[model samples]
Target: MVAVTDKSILGCRYGSSQPQRDTVLYADLYREGRLLLDELVTETYPVEDFAKAADDAHHGRVARGVLVF
Candidate 1:
């Protein structure tokens, strides 16, 4: 077996220089129902059950899992 590598593929870490502005924009979108976080969450678990959520995610059972405080 031979391994092929793609030099075009690159990974970069990203951060927001204006986090506050981004936060406000997202908040507005959420408030308007344009960004439905509930729709993105497949399931939610209490903080104590984080391991369960992690397992579900690893097994491809969950796309998004919310860990509530």
Candidate 2:
């Protein structure tokens, strides 16, 4: 399994700058990285949808997956 640190992931998500926030740069990086994953999946799940998936996974209510990047 690939272990991604929170700091690195957050940096990818929010960028390392203040103004402009480098959003586009980070987004490009994320797309490239995610493309290397086993699955070529992309979806925008709302909070409720995520929570339900987590519940099903564990048979209990739990916070859904949080992708800092």
- For candidate 1, the per-residue lDDT at 53 reads 92
lDDT of 2 by residue, 1-69 (tens): 987776543335434575465667667767888535324333334565765556554763433343232
User: TM per model?
Assistant: 0.70, 0.27
- Predicted structure 1, TM vs. truth: 0.70
| Cα-based lDDT at residue 49, candidate 1 | 99
Off-target runs (Cα >4 Å) in candidate 2 are: 1-16, 19-21, 34-60, 65-69
Note the Cα lDDT for every prediction shown. 0.87, 0.52
lDDT tens digits by residue: candidate 1, 1-69: 987887576665554346668889888999999988788889999999989999999999999899999
Q: How many backbone clashes does candidate 1 have?
A: 0
